[model samples]
Target: MGKAKKFRGLKFKYKVDGINKQLTDKYQTIEEFLEAEFPKNNNPLSPTGDTKIYDVTWNTHKVSINKIVNTLSDLRKVLSVDCYVTNTDIRLEKIKPRELERKSTYSIEQIRELTKEVLFEEDKRNAKVELDGDIIKGNSQRYQTFFTKGIKCVCCGIEGKYFAKEKVYRDKSYHLNLYAVDENGKEVLMTKDHILPKSKGGQDHIDNYQTMCVNCNVAKGNNLED
Candidate 1:
């Protein structure tokens, strides 16, 4: 129903370092001198990989906050990522967006829930069905559209029989491909979206379907409150 969620990445490196005057003061044990010069470097990307530690002399000993921000800002300008001069800092410069963020129209679990919910939501609405007294037409045949057709996104073009249920959303004139066996192998006509929506007095038991692309489907959202 909405565009796929996007990820916003915010990243920059901090020094996490200190000063070194080891040349002026000599130490007998190399371990003592090394510990004092490079106090923190225990981070390991993988357990089996070589560990790298940071040392004071790695830079000009003048890596400023402003400099790091400027570097990150330059990268943001080049890569077209979001950047800013300041956030909710303690002194109006400390707060910043988290290093990485992802936005979603639905959560993973909600998506799983909506996989079926979006399709079924229409059928459950208080919309009335035309019928003869004590006799409902096509419910029996159309209720079983899943078994008749197959599970796929009736909205987006992504297709597969991976839907959780087969029968539930069949009445929607679901999106699909039309196929037939040919002289040797087979022939397939691309499936299509409905030019008319069933909710807008269109036939639920239609004999023809029109393939709708993702952009078109989304663009046509809620024409029948689609």
Candidate 2:
């Protein structure tokens, strides 16, 4: 016979996606959030709370699969929680990676329905947005890749287009950062320029490039140094 199930009953593993802060901020902490959302009897963590009896990591929580499938479908989609049946013979390591994985043994129809629901909720959230000046602010996460690398303008030290307004907004709010505008408060266009002149045999590549505002780029055109 197959080895006895690790869990006596069906088990589910879950992790919440951290993206929209407004939705997450509604709950002060992760523990509070889970307690309020899940049944009181299922206490995701141990009584002492120092260690998780069911969770593999701080973020991953475990529950009886029946309880979640019966009750938490709507909540899971709203919170963007990724959950899967954990007592299955198959494992994630056995399958190719998926952008989003459905519960093991779920039908293709079920997966499609769940995927549609998630997409609908995301589109609904994205529809609600407010612009701040030149910035098209929204719940969507962007600039994450560059941020990981600490990309910033070498000249003005401006981190990003969004960072510009946050740094220079005065009174109520302004559109441009101090470094992005001139003395007259006019917007300064920006571009990539060569630190060593291309005509002077500097290879045309990113290694030779530097960030420069339009005014600075034009003023220093064809010259090796500022």
- Name the candidate that leads on lDDT: 2
TM-score, per-candidate, Cα-based: 0.19, 0.24
lDDT (0 to 1) per candidate:
0.28, 0.33
How far residue 28's Cα lies from its native spot in candidate 1, in Å, is 85
Clash pairs for candidate 2: none
Give candidate 1's error at residue 65 in angstroms.
54
Q: Model 2, which residues run further than 4 Å from truth? A: 1-179, 223-226
lDDT of 2: 0.33
Tens-digit per-residue lDDT, 58-163, candidate 1:
1112112322232222322222322222222101122221311212122223323333323333442322232222112222222233333542336654443221
